[model samples]
Target: MPRKAPSITHKRSRASKPKVTTGCLTCKVRRIKCDESKPHCNRCLRTGRNCDGYAPPLPRPTAITTQPTSTIAHLPSLSAVLISLPGTPSERHSFHFFLSHTAPQLRGLFESPFWSQHVLQACLREEAIWHAAVALGAVHGRFYAEGGEGGERQMWEGEGFAIKQYVKAISCLTRRGGGERRIDVALMACVLFTCFESLRGHHAPALVHLDNGVNLLLELQSLEKPRNLITQTYPPTPYTPLSALQALLTRLDTQATQLLPSRHTRLHPVSTPPTHYETFISLEEAQRASDELWNYCLYTLQPSYPSPYLHPQPQPSHDDLAHRQASYATALTTYLTTKPPRTAREQQAGHMLRLHTLVATLSLSTTSLPASEDVWDTHTPSFAAIVDLARRIIDLDTDVDIYAPETGRVGLDTGVLGPLYLTALRCRDPMVRREAVELLKKERRREGLWDSTLLAIVAERAVGIEEGGCKSELDTGRISDVDVVFDPEGCRAGVRFLLEGGRGSVEGHRGLVLTTDLPRGQNTY
Candidate 1:
C-alpha cells in the first residue's frame, strides 16, 4: 500500500537555477544584479541617458531604526549640530592651553631629581627593588611609565610588574642547570648586590653587600660549562656575564677610594695637624680604612661572580693606594715626632729619605685628576692632590719609574716618561707633551696605537723644530696628534676656520684640508 501511494511522487532533477539579469543602474538602485554589458543598458538606453553598472548600497542593520518622524522634523542640519556641540567648542578653545600648561608639567616630573630620589627611597621594597634592577639590567627605558593616575602612580605600577618579572627570572636562573642546588649562587649574589647598590646610595652597607656577593660566588665549587644556574630551579632565561659584575664592583671600589678624600678630611697625619680646613689628619688611619674597604671589595669579587666554566686564573694582588698612603702618612707622623738626629746621623737621614720616598709613592698612587676642562670642576680637587703627590715622588727620586710595569705602575708620575699623556694634554704641560711623544713612539713600535689626534698634538707642539715645524698646513695623509681624536663628524668643525681665511687651505680636496698653499714641488712631493 505504501509503494502504491509513492507511485504518485515527483521526479528528481540535477539542473541549477539561472542567475537574474538587470541593467547596472537599475540593479544598483534596486540593490540587485547587473548584467554588466557594455554600451548602454536597456533601461538607460531606452530613457536616452548614460548607464553605470550596478553598485549595491550599504545595508543598515534592521536593529537601527530611524528617529520618530516628529523628532526628525525639528532636527537641525549636521553643520548646525556640530557647531552647537558644547564639548567640541571648549576643546577647540583650550587646545593651546592644554598643550602649554599640561605637557610641560608631565615632562618636568620625568626629569626631576626629586622624582628619582623618591622612587629609589620610597618605593624600594623587595619586589619593587628587584623589578627596578631588572629594568636597569634589561635597559628597557620605555617600560618606565604607562597609564595611571599620575607619574608616581605609573612608576609604582610599572616597577611592580618589572619586579615580578625579575623575581621570575631569578627563579628561572636558579633552576636552569637542574635545580636550585645547582644554581650559581655567586652570580645571584652579584645580581643581588648590584640591585641593592642601585636602590641605595653608595654606602658602607653597599660594600658589605658586594662582599657577600663575592663570597657567594666563591662558594660555587662546581666548574661546569653551559650550566644554567637559574634553570636548576625554574626555567631557562638569559643572564649577564659574571666577569662583567666583578668589573662593575672593581670600578665602584675605585670610585669610592677617589671619593673618600673629599668626604673625610682626616686622610693623612701631619706634625702640626695642618690647620688648613681641608687637610687630611692621618694618612695611616686613612690607609687602614682604605685597606679595609679594598679588602671588602675584593672579598665581594670572589666566588660571588665566578667564571662560568673553569676557575679563573689567579692574578697578582695590588694593595689599595689609599691604604698605602695611610701607612706613609702614619710613618711621616712618626718621623716628625722623632727627636733631632745627632748620633748615627747617616742612618737617620737614610730612614727619613726612605719614609719620604714611601710617602711620595703613596700620594702618587692615591690621586687621580681629570685631564679635561669639562670634568675639571668635578675632578680638580682629587686630581690636584694626586698630581702634587706625583710631583713630590719625582722630586725625591728622579730615577724612579712611576709607571714601571715591574714596580706596579703607581701613579701619573711622568718624570722623563712625560706626565701621564692624558694628564699632560689636560694640563698643557710641555714636559708631559714630550713624554707623550716618547710614550706614543714606544706604543707605536709595540702596538700600532697611533691616531690622527695624537699626531696633531705632536705636530702642534713641534712647531719650533725645522723639520716638524708648526706649519698649520698638514701634508696629505699626515695624521693629527692630540689628546683625543676627532670623529669624521667632528672633522667638519674646521669649516668655520677655513671660511674665515685661517692659515690652513680649505679650497682643495673637496672642502677638507687646513694648510698653506704649497709650491708645486712640495705638492708633488
Candidate 2:
C-alpha cells in the first residue's frame, strides 16, 4: 500500500530455467529451451528446424590421469575416441571379415545376437577383448583363405598374430581383479579365445578358455543374489546380454568336455536343468540332455580313473542309462509330434531337436550294448532312427533353401555332422550310409571344429573297412568311382559287405583298427 502510494511499480519474480549446456547446436543457436533428447531436441522438433546433432562430449578435466579405483566413474566412457582406434591393415581386414562372415556363422538359426552385439560392445572397451576379437578374425580369415597362393604363409602369419594377441589378452585379464565391469570384459575375452581356438582346430585350448569364461560368468551371476525374498521380487535388476553368451559358452563347454578325458567331466551348472523350465523341456533342456548324453557316452567309451590326488570318475549305472534314454525319447516325441511349426525358426528348431534326439539315442544304445555283440547289429534301430531323422532334415532344409536361397540350412554346426558321421559308420546299407557320406562331403566346412572334410575321410575309411574294401583299393586309391551314392528310399534294400575282405589277417583287423582310430584320445566328432 505504501509502495503503491509512492507510485512504485511491482515486478513479478521469474524462476531461472535449466541451462542447456549439452543441447544440440540448433537449439543453442535458436536460444530456446531444449529438452535434450537423443537424435533431436524437442524444441527443435517442435519448431520444425533441422537439428544439428550433439557435439562429442569432452572428458572432465581431472588432475589424476589414472585412478586406482575400479568405479564406473573412473572407467573410460564409450565415447573415448581411442576406445576403438583402428588397427593395422591386415587386422582391420580380418575384423571386417569377422563382422561380415564369422559373426553370422557364430550364431544359431534362432540364437540371440550375443556375439554380434554385447560381446562386440565389450570388445570396444577392453584391450583383452580387442585382441581376442582380432585373433578370432585372423583365424577365420586364414580358414577361408586356405588353398590360395601363399596360403600356408598366410595361415602361419595369422597364427602368429593370434598367439601374440592371445598371450596379451591372458596377461591383461589375469592382472584385472573381479570388478563387475572388468569381469564382463574378461569373460568376453575368454569366450572369444575359446572361439579362436575352436576355429583354429585346437580344442584343448578352447576348453581351457571355456572353463575360465564359465567360471567368471558363474561368479557374476552369483553376485546379484538377494539378501531376502522381498528384495528379489520388489526390484528386478536390469539384465545384461552376457547371459545369452553364457548359455552359448556352456554349450561350448559341453562339446569340449566330450573331447576331454573322463577325469575332466564335472557338474557343469550350465548343463543342468534350468530353474525356468516348468511343464515341458525348453530348447536349453533339450540341449542339456543331448550334451549330457553325449558326455555320458564319452565316459562310457573311455572310462578312466582320476589322478591319485583326485577321486575316480563316476560310472553311470544301468538304471541311469535307462532313465536318460527314456527322457530323450520323450523329448524327441514331444518335438516331432508337436503341431507343425509356424515359423522358419520353429522349423529349424525342430530339425535341431530331432538331430539331438537321434544322436543321443545312438549314443545311449551303443554304449549300453554288450561289448561282445556286433555293434552294428545291436544298434540297428538307432541307425534306422538316425536315417529317418536325417532324411527329414534334408527335406526340410531343401524346402527352406527353395524359399530363401540365402539362408541355406544353418550350416554352422546345426548338430548335423555328428549324427551323420555316426550314421555313416554304423549303417551297412551303402545307399543310406552313402547318403550320410554324401552329406558330409558336400557340407565341406568346419562344423565348430569338426572339419567336414576330416569327418568325410574318417567316415569313408570306416565305410570301406565295414563294407569290405581290399587293402590295395585303400592303398592304391583305386576305390575311386566306387558307387557309394544312392537315393534315400531306393537304397532301402540292405546290402551287407563281409567284414573279412580276403586281405589276410591284416584285413580282418582293419575294422577294429579303424574303430580304434576313430577320433580317439583328444579327438572328437
Q: Can you tell me which runs of candidate 2 are displaced by over 4 Å?
A: 1-93, 142-171, 174-187, 202-250, 256-285, 288-316, 391-414, 472-525
Give the number of the best model, judged by TM-score. 2
True lDDT of residue 259, candidate 2 = 27
Write one digit per residue (lDDT tens) for candidate 2, span 1-525.
000111111222324445445676555433346688987777666645556556553333222111122222222322342224355655555555455446655755544446435545545456666667778877666655442224233533636776786787777677776443344465567777867766555555665777777666554444245446323432132122445555566566555444222224432233432212222345545654555565455444454533332234355575576566666667556655765666544576677777676676656666666542255655656666776776665555533311111112222344676678767866656777887887766552455535554456556666765565536343321111111211122111111222332342332232211122222222111
Badly placed stretches (over 4 Å) of model 1 are 1-133, 137-158, 169-189, 200-209, 220-245, 253-525
State the local distance difference test value for candidate 1: 0.30
How high is the CA lDDT of each candidate model? Answer: 0.30, 0.51
Instruction: State each model's C-alpha RMSD to the native.
Output: 35.1, 20.0
Candidate 1 lDDT tens digits, 213-310: 54444333244523465234321221233333333344344333332211211111101112112222343332333333333433332233334433
Candidate 2 residue 346 C-alpha distance from true site, Å: 2.6
